[model samples]
Target: MDWDDLRIFLAVARTESLSGAGRRLAMDASTVGRRIARLEAAVGAALFLKTPQGYALTAEGARLVAPSEAAELAATAASEAVRAEAGITGQLRIGAPDGCANYLLPQVARDLCDAHPGLEVQIVALPRVVNLTRREADMAIAVSPPDTGRLMVQRLVDYQLHLAGHRDYLARHPPLRDLADLKGHRMISYIPDMIFDRELDYLSATGMEVAQISSNSVAVQMQAVRAGAGLGIVHDFAIPFAPGLQRILTDRIALRRSFWLIRHADDRASRRLSLLADALAQGIRAEVLRLEGLLGPCPVRGT
Candidate 1:
């Protein structure tokens, strides 16, 4: 019946662990546990089932999530109404690929924090798609949009990638005048079979040799490229950060892709969520343009 109890319950539900929820709420594990127990007593149903992995939500817990979120939103709205000028406040966890998490999201986070000092942002750098259904993140940035789910998808921005190499490697290797010249040289890329997205499986289609150095992570691939591992397709926004990295065959080979901002459909009515989402989209769009522009005009453009 109490909003505080529902708040704690929701935190535990999302984190799937008392300690994690405690950390987020600035309370200790024992306190979170007691609060959850109290919530269960009030509802007359066990909400979480303990497991080796932590707490797994029971069927009743799954059902409680929606109404609990609705209550949380109402409480937040009431709080915001009293402090209308302070801006939206609360923590938000965003799931994104390492490429964006490491390079792009930081910029967005910085801007958002500067604008709204009370806001907190958590970046969950996951190699796989973030599951909104399980509440893996409050929101996610995905390379592809999902057709099935109770979700709201927004096209955040379009970005480009190109085969690139470190200046040191370029100096030692034979000149890369065209795609044909890429055949004999080594490459740094994702493991072909481990490629999670069809969009990421294009290294083979480039007529280049198989990857000599591989990782599932874009951040790792970027590091390998900078360490002179081999040629890798890298985000344009990321290229400027790697001091010696330069696009290879930019005119002949460029991959254009889009980033989508995804949210649970149930959050569609939350004004606080909308505010945060708008800031995220705008910040990402601006930062991508700024970073990519550091290299001057590219032969390709975003769709």
Candidate 2:
């Protein structure tokens, strides 16, 4: 019945682990457990079913989801109203692909937090789709917009990817005169089956069938290329950081892809969410411009 108890329940349901929920709430695991027990007693019904995998919401808990979310939104609105008279203070979670999350989000997060001292930001670097409907994240950068969700989607920015290799690897191997020559090279790429998003299937466009070396992480793939393993597709924004890596066939081959910013429709009017979204979009646009300066103009129009 207490709003604080409902907040704990929401966190536990979203994270599905006592420790994870506790970390979000800044409480210890035992305390989170005790609170859940107290909440169940108040409701006079079991809320979560414990399983080896994690806590699963019971029927009673599932029924509480909508009301809990409504309460959360109302609390957010109230907080935002007060923030106008004071300053912004709340948590904002963003979900993004590992590549972007690892390379880009940290600096942006720091800047946002610095500007708003009381604000907290968490970045979920996940390869799978982040369910905005389930409150997995307040906002997400996705390859494609959802078709069925009640969401507000906007094109964030377009970035370029190109085939690249380490300077040492290029010197040791035959020169890549054309696309066909790539067939003989030990290409590095994502594990095909592990590519969660269709937009990540860069190899298919290259007409390359084999990946002699592969990894699920872009950071690993970049490391593989840096170690002289082989040529691989890499983001232009990432290339500037890896001094030894050089773009191959810059004019002949360029891939353009875009990231879409998505959030729940209900959160559209939230001042904090709107401000954060604008800041995110600006940061991404600035990065894209920097990448284009280094990689030459993007080959495709309106990516």
Instruction: Report clashes for each candidate as comma-separated counts.
Output: 0, 0
Give candidate 1's error at residue 4 in angstroms: 2.1
lDDT of 1 by residue, 140-192 (tens): 99999988999999999899998888989988888877677887678888887
lDDT of each: 0.87, 0.85
Weakest 10 consecutive residues of candidate 1 by summed lDDT? 294-303
Please give each candidate's TM-score: 0.88, 0.90
**lDDT score, candidate 2, position 241:** 68
